[model samples]
Target: MGTQQTTQDKYYVVVAGDTLSGIASRFRTTVKQLQIWNNISDPNIIKVGQRLLVAKATAGEPQPGDPSFVPFPGGEWFKTLPTSPIIEMMGLRLVEEGCGAAYGFSGPGPKWNDKHRQAYACFQSALGYSGSDADGWPGRKSWDQLRVPFPEEGCDAQ
Candidate 1:
């Protein structure tokens, strides 16, 4: 019987000194699993900023956050809003739709990661945007589609 590799329900980003073997060990996954998850043709090579799917996603995990999930003081959602758990929650919904990279979400704080970018692209594509429109960024249509809460009272659905 072939031994099965185990992984977590999250994603891991490659850092400056990360190795496939090291990552596999850190996530308790096998190098082969990492290769398959990230489609690495060469296990010996991985970029520092590359995202790796180290685990399987949970059933209905990390869905888009409700209006109350905002980690900030007020729910001021909008295009180019500061990063927060709200963004991470949207990323989860993207994963459920299968546009999420095999990897998972990261930087639920004031930063961005490849995982989110890929998922954002998926969201944009799903919204019928193509060419440059599909670039991995947010818009009112997507915010409504993804159910991101309003940042202010005057902001109506576009």
Candidate 2:
């Protein structure tokens, strides 16, 4: 019955005797997820005092159309687009939603490709969309639902 030590309910600090599986079990997540979130290539190497993201960041008080929020670039935009940091953010969101399989070994790179569409389709399916609606296109509804954060600094995508 060891209590879990966390910060802001988002991160967990590793303590002596802590194991990745134990932490994942306590957090109701998977070890693979812990590895992915923390970028830990070796699950056995977590050290004491190490901080790890155990939960997704909540939207909190931020609302749509906020200056720091990313707006939908229209469904067609995902089709004809070349590359944008926004797309990378979208793919990251999709992967966060359990659609990482779409990217496979390549991952969600900063490119608009079939992998992006496949991941978007998984996201749309997760939202209960089907058929043409979930045809892997980034519609306004799904785009907003994805809740892509504002692009990182130095990224030119809107």
Candidate 3:
């Protein structure tokens, strides 16, 4: 009889502060595959001492630099907006033309009135402005601030 060759599966012990994405990258496998193999419903929920089965590389698998799997450099430097196309579309308009324009829909303002100023403050807060709201209306400093990850060109989108 001929001798048979056996391949043993490799396993990894999960450590504290280990994330599924981090572990999957280290093992050269996709998070989806690891989840499927181990019947994990939530990739984000992993515990220390969990045993992970490392799968062998497969054909047509995504490479490290593949667009879908690639880690964006400086990604952490920017914040992602919540998904709401309607909000994005409308919010962009409000940001562009809502409060800061001359006689815009945000309320007629050479300088905003109390109500107008309150609305402006809310808008500023929504846009992630971190400065004091005591002054209400956005000033030179507010315009210089990078709030919603988009250009704060004077609202003219009307």
Candidate 4:
């Protein structure tokens, strides 16, 4: 929005086929608000997987971009060849939770692969999710519970 950034803000990760107006409608906010919140001068310039502030955070929400706050990138994000620090952060968190013991050849790297999925499934199972819920795809609830640490200082997450 401005040089003075708001520390606490709610975020939404953009996904395929999303338009600025569509996102605004989905979040029940105005496109103008989205622009102001994200400092987006061109409404059509948003890219897939981009994170946008949808609203101001209420009490108890974590600060935006802080290590304690990680927004849920949609499940579709994992299907793609993601290379963000967030992926590595998630892998480490899963391993910490005892889900990534067999991380295959490269170990817990920054790309999405079967290893990550398998480990995530293990985490989900530990959390008591089963059937379709424990399919290794990260849902909002499971993701929030995972608590992937924010990327190290100076390392931006996608």
Candidate 5:
């Protein structure tokens, strides 16, 4: 669908798979600018079907590509995993992204090994999460950005 435009800004309807970064990238704006315009506290907590206003950048406004965003894992997680497939998938994706030189590669394994955590933290840091945000806690924001694959659907007892 086309973005709606107003007198001084544009608008986008959040879809099922929309992220602030993705949206900002599409609109040629920054996540921080979108947040400031929309009063969003968390860049990762956008609701589906939500209409977001994008203020049009003037000549002096910070043009696109202010803070380049690192790409996240481009995959979905299983809904009902037998084990910790989510972590494993993230780890695998990290290695695929060439950020796992220190961790090597061992995805779809049973354990959320040290390599997994290190890769996850690396991902967080790349996404600009420093301090406590990059604590490798598998937060929803990062997980969403990671595009966690859907689980097998009913494997809570392994």
Candidate 6:
């Protein structure tokens, strides 16, 4: 299909697989600015057919090399702890403890062992649980009782 043009002022067309970040980067703007211009309440809800109004270029526009185009990860929450590390640690401990066979690790290797320990540490930090580095291995309590911050809606917009 041919490129779609914006009629209401200068706007950018949302393409397939296009994220607000990617679009902002291309146009030397920010995701926040795009959201504000388009009255976009939901940053994640932009569709392929929506037109995003970029700011009108004026004489005082930001220079090309300026750091004005970085796209923010505009989710409802800040970066929380990642869950993969916790899961990996649990799986690794199961293998090391002879409770289950490890899927990705082949035989006894230092890399796998180190990875398991790292995962355990991450899991501890995420759950706000504390333990000695040497003694902290994946446990049922750590894995099962991990709590993540949920996105709270209807709060005042920042």
The TM-scores of all predictions, comma-separated, are 0.39, 0.59, 0.33, 0.55, 0.41, 0.34
> Which lDDT tens digits does candidate 6 get at residues 1-158?
11223333567788899887566545544555677788988767789988888745444433332223211212221123223332333343334333333344453232325445454455455446665632435443443332111122211112
lDDT of candidate 3 vs native?
0.46
Error of 6 at 75 (Å): 30
lDDT of 1 by residue, 34-76 (tens): 7877899998899988988876654432322323222223323
Deviation in angstroms for 28 in model 5?
15
List, residue by residue over 1-158, the lDDT tens digit for candidate 2. 22223334488899999988677646644566689889999977899999998755544543334344477877677777659888887787676667879798878988899998888888788778999998998887777656676666745654
Q: Summarize candidate 4's per-residue lDDT along 1-158 as a digit string, tens digits.
A: 21123446768999899888667645544565589889999977999889999867555433333335467888887777688788888887776566877596566988887888889999789879999999998887778666566676634544
> What CA root-mean-square deviation does each model show from the true structure?
13.4, 8.0, 17.4, 16.2, 14.7, 17.2
Clashes per prediction?
2, 0, 2, 0, 13, 0
Best TM-score among the predictions, by candidate number: 2
TM-score (C-alpha, index-matched) for candidate 1? 0.39
lDDT of each: 0.56, 0.73, 0.46, 0.73, 0.57, 0.45
Lowest summed lDDT window (length 10), candidate 6: 148-157
- After superposition on all CA atoms, how large is the RMSD of candidate 4? 16.2
144: Cα error in model 4, Å = 0.2
Better structure of 4 and 6 per lDDT: 4
lDDT of 5: 0.57
